[model samples]
Target chain A: MFEVENLTKKYDGFTLDGVSFKIERGYITGFIGANGAGKSTTLRSMLGVIKPDSGKVRAFGLDFEKNEQEIKNRIAFSSGAFDYYSHERADRVAKYYSNFFAKWDNEKYEHYKKVFSLDGKKKVRDFSAGMKVKFSLALALSHGAELFVFDEPTSGLDPIARDEMLTIFQDIVADGQKSVLYSTHITSDLDKCADYILFIHEGKIILDGTKEDIISEHTIVYGEKEQAATVKEKAIGIKENAYSFSALMKKSDAHSLSLTQEIPNLEDIMVYYSKGGKR
Target chain B: MSKNLKRRGTLCAILKKELFLATPLPFYLFALLGLMTAIPSYPIIVGIGYVALAIFNSDGFRRSNRDVEFTCTLPVERKDVVTSKTIFVVVIELLTLVFGVVGALLSVFLSSPNGNVVGLDPNLTFFGVAFSCFGVFNICYIPGYFKTGYKSGIPVLKGTIALLLVYSLVETAVNVVPRFNVIFDSLWGDFVFARAIVLVVGVIAYIILTVVANRIAQKRFEKVSL
Candidate 1:
């Protein structure tokens, strides 16, 4: 339901080069990258928070510039921080926020407020970090938003809170009509619920596919330090210790390399890919 | 057209949010100082300064509150964001001017009839001067703050300097020129009724400059990377 085309932004020393991705409907797309990997930059550019040097973002079949108000009405976005009107209560903020969108559902808002166990009268600044994320999600969901775009919503949350966030995301899409695109360095949450994965390294999109396809396409190769070369020759990226080594290579390449191969997780992929450093 | 109505709806909703949500209670408390115009022997222009300082200080609040970042998530355009903010500032300024008017009327009875020996008298001309000073502040601070969308200290500093300069120059000219007293003279004396003319021109200038400032702020803010 959302697409970014050739998004490029430049700064003094960094550039988001030809970044592109498409998020499918009814699935959670986890945009994973290290900090300063241009994840926020890309998302900001797409959302028009920052004008891109040059790019196009289409959402729900409408051009962002031409139909910003209409499109924004249909979409809900947050950085997962309840920093807007921070001095106000959630109930007060909701009253103000609901006016901006035609699809705002007060009953649904009440429902989520109860589901999240949010204190309506308390000031948002008093809430803990996890509570803030939950508050943001409740607001996003109450608006009957078809697409939810969040930036690092799970960061700084406890493991149980993160798991709750993942479940909320899963429940959001289980109906097979909604879509979510959340960017984060935290992959453990995604491991539980994300269906699609878009891995960004530096400014470019390095990997984009289904979670299963991406995990299955790569394997971890490891042995004694002396045999590092066997994996290094065919490996895309490798890390070595004094006594042993682990490298990442395509499943096909690892099979032919005749080295011990193991299945990889999202974190392993991020670790090995990031070793390449700034491109 | 329905498109125009839709656009107006968004603007009105955002304006409401700005006044009720975005703007803080401290802003209203500071505006109460606009009543300082009633203080006898005071420059009365200081009341306008109160409003200007409040406007400048609110920029710091906007930065800390992350108003730009929060507004970007709403169902509004970049232009809408800046437009609503400009309107909010001007509305508070107008309210302050309202208080200044009441105080000026009271000053007519409470202060010296020949006008204060201090600076400018809190007369009809004072409102004109007030409007002009506020206009100068709008020109400086609007574009200045919107240019960065984050930094406000330096912008407010520059705006304050400009505001003070305008206040001093105008007050000094009226007090020292001797011939420009026609501005404070009889309603129909000469120069096509000087007091009325000054009031009309000052109000118009304030309106025009505010419109220009809003336009400039909107354009600059559109380029900001929030």
Candidate 2:
């Protein structure tokens, strides 16, 4: 239930050019992008952490500016690099935030503390990186939020910790009422958890769709000189080999052109699309 | 919700955060220092009290990039956020006055006035100096909150330099011109009364400046990109 309309933000070195998107309720949406792709910028604007140069961000059918407090109360956000008040014990921080958030569930926080194996009495600075990430997620989850926005939530976690995180996310989405916007470079996690993928490049959303539609509906073409001519010039980039070429075109076109094979996986598609492949 | 209540809630949040970090250390240090000094130079002691309050309250403004980003994510309005910070400084100023008196009392007891220590009016003079220092602290302290994203290092350095320069200039002028004491004498019969007037006037000036800073801080925070 989030909509970003004609969101334009200009900076000295980068510009988010009127990017627009809608996140359906009851689905995990992955904001996928490489470094410096403006994914963090877009997420920040959505959370009202930073003001956009122009345009509107609507959450839960309300303008962010008008219903900021209400929207914030219903949503929880966490990032991998984000830190808790370091000198504060996790328990102390929880106590402090209990007043700020109306729906802060003390039972849920206790449950998470055990599940994450975090000592609530220990200062946050004493926790390991994985522990810190888990602590942040615990805080977000304990707030009884309807929507969770995670920015690279599993970046620094160990493999086991990352798996645990994914499991928690899966459990969160099982109710079919909650939603999440998970921004991460980890496509594998998205493949396991995200229902929708929005690929941001520079500042524009270059690709947006469900995982199946994004991967299965498209085809990557690789062939010799003759096959290169079969593809449209505008859609093709430089020919890598004398008798070999690769291009991205519709799968339907593949049947018409007698194509070779379909390159599956989100990563390949992202690489192909980012490197000037078009359809 | 009433706007005033909301503002107060926001202010409470900021004050709580600051108190958690710095309530006992620097705040109590002043009391300790005052006890050690034993109330000899009332004016200097009051000035120290003011600076201590200002510095302690000002710590909240120093934040790393991550802290700023996290804080901005809270639901509070930008104006309320800025106002809450200003309120925090004011609360510290008020607390400083209370502690300042306690310090003065300790100072008076420990000094055990000797014959050489003459012309030291312990009653009115001590309270007046302490109160005036609090007022001066308010005047100098509130403006820094308007700075970008609660940063204080620049403000702290600049404020210190400015205060020193002003003090030096005033001292030089009063010394170079023999009739300056005559002008001062006409202003107030004694130092205590003059300091009291300064305290009152400074507080009034501080309130006005706080309103201005609140407006500017609110406007600036609103435009700040996350």
Candidate 3:
């Protein structure tokens, strides 16, 4: 449903160079990156929020620049910042947003408000961080959006709220018609809900594939320092300590070495890659 | 709805949100300060009200941080955002002008039976000066605010300085230069034709400023990152 090609944007100290990715319908694509890794910049460029120096972003098969309003009308973008209408009451904000969206469902808005336990009369600034995220999600879901782009929606939420958000996201894409492109530093949230993972570090896409494929292909091997040294050249990302070390290698590579292999989760992979991965 | 109609709806929505976020304090303050026009020599008080309104209006994006969400997430185009804000500024300036005129009329009625004051008539000149002030201020403020979003301090400062300089230059010409004073008096002091000419020129300048401001703001805002 969304495609970004060679998206490049330059700033004072950082540049997002040739970043490209795509998200299909009916799946949650997790955009994972460390802080200042150009995740938000890439998303903003895709949304036509920040114009890229040169590149193209297509949404729903339409060029974003040429059909910006039409494309935006069909997508709902939510962020944890909640900077849209901080001073207005929740209901008033809903009313204001409803005017722009053609398919805005007031009934759905009321349903989500009750489900999220959002008080319509309260100013947005008064809401807790978790409440603010929930309110943003509620707005995103009420507009009949086919694609939901959420930036750090679960960043500051408690464990329970994060789980609830993941469940909600799962439900959103269950029908195989809607999709979500979620960007966050929290890899655990993706473990619970994402179908595809796009890993970015230092403005480059280091990994992009199905979650199952990525988890199955990479294995974390633990060994003494000497064994780690022998495998250092072949391992993708390596971490060392005083007496022992662990390295991430493909399951195929580990099978031939006769080393102890531990199943690597999303966090383990991201941690290793972010720490010392070359690619 | 038609695409143009939908875009208009979006613009209206944006305008509504801006007005709501622009809190009523500035309007109240303008009204209170506008009462200064009751005294003839303090007509500059009305100008102060206009300047204050311009500053506060330009500060709206920074005060609320609305530009980020508006530019990034909302479905509206950057041009629409600029257009709606330009319309809002014009509307507010017009309201300030109306209030200033009302206050001047009230002062005239109370001061004398013939509705004449000791100094300037405070009718055409008041609008002329007010519109000119808005034109100059917005010519500076809008493009800067659009370029940098909330970091428009330099532009607003320059605009204010430009405003003061223009007024000072005009004041100096009327006071220091004798031949200029005679011509200024002929045009501004009593001739209805000359006053109408000034009003027309002010209106034209205001329109040109609004158009130019919107164009520059749209271009700059389109390039600005959230």
Query: In model 2 chain A, which range of ten residues has the least summed lDDT?
Result: A232-241
Chain B TM-scores of the candidates: 0.90, 0.61, 0.81
Most DockQ-accurate candidate: 1
lDDT of each: 0.83, 0.66, 0.77
CA-based DockQ, model 1: 0.79
Q: Which runs in model 3 stand beyond 4 Å of their true positions?
A: A277-279, B22-32, B43-46, B57-62, B110-121, B177-190
> Tens digit of lDDT per residue, candidate 2, span A6-95?
788889999987888998878889888888888888888877776788888898889998878778878888866447577668787767
Best by lDDT: 1
lDDT of 3 by residue, A1-279 (tens): 888899998989898989988899999999999999988888878887778898888888899898898888889887654656676788887887787788899999999999989999999889888888888888888888999988888888899989988998999999999998989999988988899999988988889999999999999998987788777877889988778889998888888887788999999988888877442
DockQ each: 0.79, 0.43, 0.62
For candidate 3, the TM-score is 0.93
Model 3 captures what fraction of native contacts? 0.70
Which pairs of residues have clashing backbones in candidate 1?
none
Highest-scoring model, TM-score: 1
Model 1 lDDT at residue B181: 56
**Inter-residue clash pairs, candidate 3:** none
TM-score of each: 0.95, 0.84, 0.93
Model 2 regions more than 4 Å off: A225-243, A277-279, B1-11, B21-65, B105-147, B165-195
